[model samples]
Target chain A: MQKNKLIAGVSAGGLALLSSPAFAQSIDETVNHLFASATGWFVNFIFSPFPGTSFPWIVAWLVVAATVFTFYFTFIQFRAFKHSISLVKGDYSDPNDAGEVSHFQALATALSGTVGLGNIAGVAVAVGIGGPGATFWMILAGLMGMASKFTECTLGVKYRNEYADGTVSGGPMYYLTKGFAERGLPGGRFLAILFSIFCILGALGGGNMFQANQAHQQISGILGDFPGWITGVVFALVVFAVIVGGLKSIAKVTEKVVPFMGVMYVGAAIIILLVNADQIGWAFGQIFAGAFTGLGVAGGMVGALIQGFKRAAFSNEAGVGSAAIAHSAVRTKEPITEGFVSLLEPFIDTVVICTMTALVIIITGQLSIDPATGNYLTEGGRIVTVTGASGVGLTSAAFESAFSWFPYVLAIAVILFAFSTMISWSYYGLKAWTYLFGEGKTTEVVFKVIFCIFVVIGAAANLGPVIDFSDAAIFAMAVVNITGLYCLMPIVKRELTSYLARLESGEIKKFK
Target chain B: MATKYIVACDGSSASGRAIKVAVEQAKLNGASLLLVHVLEWSPYSFLTPEELEERHKRRNEELKRAQLALVDPLVESLSSEGVESSAIIRYGHVSETIADIAEKEGAAQIFVGRTGQSTLTKLIFGSVAASLAQIAPVPCTIVP
Candidate 1:
């Protein structure tokens, strides 16, 4: 045992040394690559012979898409926020409901999936890279994201299928295929297949690996020199135990864990803000000025705006169809009821948690650039670079600066957030995988095992390129999912009208 | 000999009522009470086996603390009333394990709290409670 321990320690140390240098070198190369790619994309978009531009131009396209979607939906997310709360309270619970889990449980489960590291680390990254001004744009993007979530979740419910054994299955794939089939669109099947493929890839990378990587980092950071494989092996085992039992197990675990973690993390942030009371005003000032003037460490106003918008988009994921899969499992006949509940996602994730993280970072004055390299510096003397994503290390520094001995707390929170995210994303990816690869138990196990393997890779390898690739995959999913939503908006409108009519007739109130 | 009833209770107020309702039904049917609580594993799935077990043990202890706080009082009250009852705690999923325990213990009735929907509606559309009711191969009463 002693010899094994020595060997293990040496191997881990050697691996870390080898990987760290490679990671550092690759980060520089990746940053240069991103700049070149962005430059090329921008030039092509501006000077192309065609009137149109590239798909993801300046990250403003995401904001504009959200804006257009919000207006087109007539601000459904804002108007229906309270109604969503009531839906979760089971004010509209009916046995005749066609879906599976309770609206509250579904919302909790879905929230568990979305409200992970994005809120903590992602927000920190945004503020670190974009400065205080990024916070303003994140809030703006979050507000608009509410509408996008509303549209997709409603459609997810409307097109769901119930099996003979009374299990409900639905998501973007169902809506994309069935909604289009209803409209006699020729390529509905093809688009659905494409969306499912992206969802599977996304689930494995963004959902699974991203989550495990953060959790592993936190554990290793706090506990000191634990083997990386320990995290992967243990994570896979625990995840396997739950997921193998299927959605019911996942739901039960999520319902309990998500609420507790959400309250705890948010409570901690609120306490930090209260402790740092004096700096709040100055933080707000910096945020506003940096937002407009683009005078922060990120170079210009456009760069700051892009970082904020990108982070918010990453954080809330309003356009991505992943959350809709979880929401679709809700037990409700009224699709709009679930949609109302879905709006709370952005409110809780971006509007509340992300905002708190931004405040904690900004108020702590950690958003300032280092005089040496123009990069943001944490209190711990580490130069905070904005290679791709900015959430984890920055948030940890902010919490540490405030609480002093609170790195453990932030680390624990990161583990819980990331772990919950991976488990929930497993469901999303599995659903997407099952949709495409056939829903055999064997196939699921294969996907899950592969997914678990990536957890180690994500933790051990440089995430700069991998996370970017995964983020792009998720964004690609959004592009496909939102297009499907656009095509199926009429169905959502009809479902909303029908549910509203039922509400007017006192049919829903009878349950109360 | 009267058949036993297994009552699965979380610490929620509704679950407290479920225990009360199960006790009353057991008394009426001349059945014994087997109170059970299931504690779920935490989301820190990335911990080692020893760590996972350690976490589970910690959670089990917490659950035991809650059970003692809630169930001990009820057990004492029932003994004072000259009623015989027992409590069992398991660490697993609520629905499937509840059904499994009911079957193993030869429970004639299964009682659970209706946290999400009312018993009547959940009966028709089915829920965790309804799923238990359908598959437990025994009568189930969901207490709201």
Candidate 2:
């Protein structure tokens, strides 16, 4: 259904561009118009601030959800941290178990979904606009967000549809509908449908377009300027090959390559931090002070808090419920185990990796600050002052200050990050698509083709609308998911209570 | 008393030779044959969520295929030779699972074909025969 809306918008742009004699000159405008107009109302609605405040209600929605879940579960993210690690280590796993995937595999699959441009580009945006203090808020939100993951993922597994054929299907759609009906609650099906719609949009906007747009931005930083559509078309074809052509071996190769790239990216960040070891203390100081006082950055402490929480939610996706889809596939009788495993995602993506990126930007002196006023030099492009370098470009500049060839390496990483993210999101969106439209080859192909088209459109469209819609769609998911979670969280808490009791009584023994 | 002999099959000619040898031993001793086939699998693997979702289905399919192609024919042939036989198919590390089955079944001895893997392959991945020799509870014979 959403695909039809997208097709109408795209064909409108196609018609406009085809009618124009200068196709190259008008393509950007037309694509931007189509994307912005189609998604603008939804974006404005999702991000519309609470009352008169500058803070987007969507950001507050996620923040409040995470905070509440943290308390409601009595800080399960912290309590289960050690146990979660053990579960991931396979301590309780039996060799003769009939499960399909290990806890580690489930966590890794979900991590690859969450940790992408949000760590690199999104961090740079946070620090560039919100100052170093955003780093502190980002970490705080990441920690709290872990609880949200625990609740949602637990419900995801408990309510998932396990078929006799040994395949399982789950996510917000399944849990919201099934759990609601089981509880005799109204609107479960409605909310489930609504969540699926937002999920599909989120998958396309944040998962597909935002990634392609950023990948193009980084590639263009080194490769000189060209029409983004060319890059978009190339990306779309490669993605089409994997998702539609049934070349799962390519997906397998990417599954291997992406983790290696993630490690290399983190290794580079660590090396940069070590080299700038002396400034680490000062950078932390900036982060702490800016978090409270805003360090004369725009919008003061409130701006920092908003950007920190917003980007953290976007980065880790703790409350948005997408990770629950991936986590539900684990081979475990205890639904709580996957929940425990999932809490590590926000910590890794936000607290650890996002902080590394923020520290690099701050330590590498990317944000131009005036010594006398102790304010960001906002006169002439002070934030990310390396002349038009923002997002991945800003991150690339920071890393390049440490290594001359880093940009070249970064371009490769960004593209791989983008491609892998696109592939993962395709599956996510397909799940949502199948939920709404019913699962069939044709329905599946229809969604896949629309997803590929958006890849091109995302790459070609301007960043402003693409990011706005991406943030909106993702947050929209949080609204429905968290509302459903509030009703169903007690169920998760019961499961956790029972599981822990069993563990303490030695009813559940560790095999290793 | 009737005894038991275990033969590991991979459908290769080497395994066919091992089956023949195990059959001869089983018939001479009035023993039954237990034909085992272990499909190599590890809990540790990097998979996409979609692949993970379908993994159980694929595992079932592979198990069924191995049962049909590797174990059933051998079980029928052993029966025709006047040796009682049964088959078990599983998924795990080949040598380890074979050793485990041997221990569990209390077999007198075990038989496996010498794999045609290259020296470097054997060095890198470890030969199944070499692993069985180290881990099997009973005496193990490798049919070349």
Candidate 3:
């Protein structure tokens, strides 16, 4: 007990010292020095071949890759948006269909998993660091992302397994194995196993820990120094309850919750934009200027574009194939129906919701730079900002400046969004886990328990490096997933042509 | 005194035709007709208990009035032809209520129309129909 008290006393003293103006300034200086050194190292690595080569250049390369993919797929994302809406509405239900849930429910479940922090925090980070111009590139990246979603989800349904009892299992694992096996590849199973492992890791990190940490931060920020352990415990309990009930339960909850939370949050942002009415034009000007002129942030035009594209890619997760796992369980025989619905993900996420966040941040003028040093400042101290989480707080503050009670509303929305996301992602990770490990009830339950525990850990721990790592893990998964989609494009084209033929022939009628 | 059959009518033209077919089949088999129409629980499930009860009662009356309108015409026609028929109004999910009424009425068969008010095509053969088909105690037919 004496030792514990002494440690506590020492920590409090350290904190007090850290909070002093002199100490804080010194800390800032130290951080700047460290950042400079790190930036130098990164610059050297990136520019080894040429002095001007940088990380943003690599990001530009990724954007080109995504853009090329979008074109190669014949701009299917734009052409299929309306059809995607109809698909979700289940306008073409066949009696002999062989799946578990409606297309809308599948999209809802998948959206619930993908639409969380990415829309709220991810957008903010893109606009915050990348400048307003990032929004333009982000939207473009999201458009390309749609084709990726279409390819992956179609493959998810096409390669799904129907068990003896009529339950279904699918996703990248199934396609990598079954699709590749059909091509007479000797190592199809091995590749599938590897994909599943990556998916599980990606799910656990990006899907579970990242979500929980942000949720915990938001709750703790509102509640004011509430023990991290308490937040973790509550989050774990709620997550355990829903996930234990399995995918159907998760789907049911997400179907209801995703729509409600989405409308509420988006509606709030719309209200803010309306209130700011006249400044809307100026905000757009800043975004476009910051995007092209590269006058705002340190990274220049290329840096800004990369930040925007990276954030959007991270947000919608179109190419990742994780969302396809959720969509695969949808009850329908037509793989194309779910694929169509899956395309709406990036639209709602990056285009609509992310745009709203960018508007709020930009219109409020809270993200403006200091004229003397060209550094950004908020609340009068050198802005101690991490990308996603800090961006969400900036948005909340903007709303609070406009409407006094909006902070509370934003907090509630964040919790609901985060909670729904965590639950849906638990299913995604578990499927991947089951695909690689043995599929037993016990195995699933154990995974749920571990996932829930991470919620607490994520909520409590310092997550700056952790979330970065998690985001990287998710991007890595996208690399593999998009590769598979590229290779399997021919199959998607075949399915699309066949389905469109049937539609044209009137063999499938619209819902009466 | 052959086995009775329950046929549900929802007041649509298709439902009317379905009832006619069901009654003709029942008459041919020497079975009685027990026509039923179910009034669903309200969409506003988040209301207060008193409000809910009032809503439920009002819905019940509406259903009763509709059922009587359907049954009177059929009864008059049947009685003139020296045939027997009866009708009922119940409150619940359409499929579940139909299954329950069938068991209680000792029905040997059940009949339904193909579509309902909700334009959701997927749901027509979805959970409700799937459940009834799997667990209904009698054979069921859906007339398009």
Candidate 4:
């Protein structure tokens, strides 16, 4: 509720850096000289052509696609929301179906892909830039994004190819090529190739590297700075083990870990919020008030919306189509049921987890605001940006406010999140690689080994260009995926209609 | 036959003992032994068409492998010792499948292993031995 909650009460670690002028100044100068110019231009280029604003049009592209899908599906995300939950609970799944995993396992695996460091760091970054008001828009984006997830994942299952060996491969590449061919479309092959390339890049960069980097940041903050290579090497090794074991192992771990970690994270957040119960109402007021008026942010309402939309896109990755890969593994004869299952992903990842992170940051009062123009003071530097350390550190600080040793807990959670994301992405990238390279033991191992190597590079390298490339690669995937979605949406719609009819007729029995 | 006995084997020592017991029972009753092994297979029930086909294919392979590795060897050993024996392998829930085979074969009794799961593990995931004992259409014995 206080206006000047910033510049003061940084967590113990944050406070130490902020209080020491010599250390902070030197680090700031070095970081600025090293990365600011490079990142600034790269960011501007990616986000350029937003007409009146420098806002990343890719964010707008994602939001608009979500909105369109929501309207096109006649709010399927809303109407089928209950069915979606039940589908994830495996009510309609027929064990006789031809897939490797259950509906719930597929949902959990996809969720692990979507609910990574993005839920942790991405939310704090949104709130850091957009203030508390961003939470509203973030939830909005998540809700709409569900429909896009539905469309893509349905296509994923419908068009997935099963090798003679019993393993299945899916995602946008399968759908774009196979679906388009069914429709006699011209660009199916071309689009499929394009999507595969981007997906591979995205898998390595955002999926593996960025996760490693953020996990490194969180761990180093708690454990004291060790060489980033150590975190990378360990992550690389663990990721290798799970991935080399095969999709079943990844599915097994994700189904258990994602739910447990989600509960633990949200449980901790709920406890913290309950402890600060007095500020609960006040925090909502701030979120609402800041959302429309921009809370005196630099770009006003536009900035808040941009940050919320951008971070939500980055977090849940609804239209980005990576989730389709994970979801396609579901053992459902009805592909649409997996679609129903996937729609819950963004809801859980962004609407639930991301919002929790934001609320924690807001309620714990970690954001540093300027009293003059009511503008939040964001200190930009090398790796750790923002004056009070926004992103995961801000989230960490918020939790640290409640318990002195909570940073350690946050570190463990981050590593787990990072680990799960990497494993899921390994599957995604492998599918994409095999799409281009053809499926075999050798090709799959090649993709996996490359993925693990990037984990090390991501942890060890300075983040600036790596994050830029990762972000660009991810956006590149979204570009290709959304294009294919627009082309194949009619088929998705038909599937949706038939599924609803079957559901109503009780053709799809509820085994649960 | 004077009497027929079904012995379920899972390549475990308890099941081996059960096989021995079934042999002894068949010998005493001047009957025959139906040596059977059920591979535990429960589909998640959500596979795509291709995966489902593969699962069914794998199920057949598993049944064949079990018959070769488990039931065939046990049946051969029994025949060598002058216990009239036949072998079959199936894939399904362990207890139910065993019951089904015994019913279909018109066996007079059933013998099963009592190992593979501790009480706590059994509580978490249903114990096949306990379930078989409860649901067996014929007289059932659990050999430890």
How close is chain A of candidate 1 to the true chain A, as a TM-score? 0.83
Model 3 DockQ, alpha carbons vs. true complex: 0.05
The lowest-lDDT stretch of 10 consecutive residues in candidate 2 chain A is A379-388
What's the lDDT for residue A298 in model 3? 56
The lDDT leader among the candidates is 2
Residue-wise lDDT of candidate 4 within A402-483, one digit each (tens)?
Answer: 8888888788778878877776677778878989999789988888888887787677656656667677778888888999
Measured by DockQ, the strongest candidate is 2
Looking at model 2, residue A52 earns an lDDT score of 79
Q: DockQ scores for all the models shown?
A: 0.04, 0.54, 0.05, 0.16
Least well predicted 10-residue stretch by lDDT in candidate 3 chain A: A380-389
lDDT of 3 by residue, A357-448 (tens): 88888787767667796544433221334222365677777777778888787777777777777766676777778887878999988888
Give a tens-digit lDDT track for model 4, residues B102-121: 89789999999888777689
Candidate 2 residues A124-243, lDDT tens each? 888888889999999999999999999999998888888898888889999999999999999999999999999999999999999999998987878888778778999999899999
TM-score of chain A of each: 0.83, 0.96, 0.84, 0.87
Q: What's model 1's TM-score?
A: 0.69
Candidate 1 local lDDT, A1-512, one digit each (tens): 53354345445545655778444334323333443343344234422332263224525545666787788868887777777877777666652231224565666667777788888877776676667778888888899988888889888878876555445678899988888999877777888898998888788767876777677767776778554545766877777766664544544555566667779778878998888788788778777787886553444565566667777877787888887887776555567888888889888888898999888877766655667854355433222543322458777777777677677877766777777788777777877888888878799888887777656545544445445655666776887888787788777788777777887897668454
User: Native-contact recovery for every candidate?
Assistant: 0.00, 0.63, 0.00, 0.03
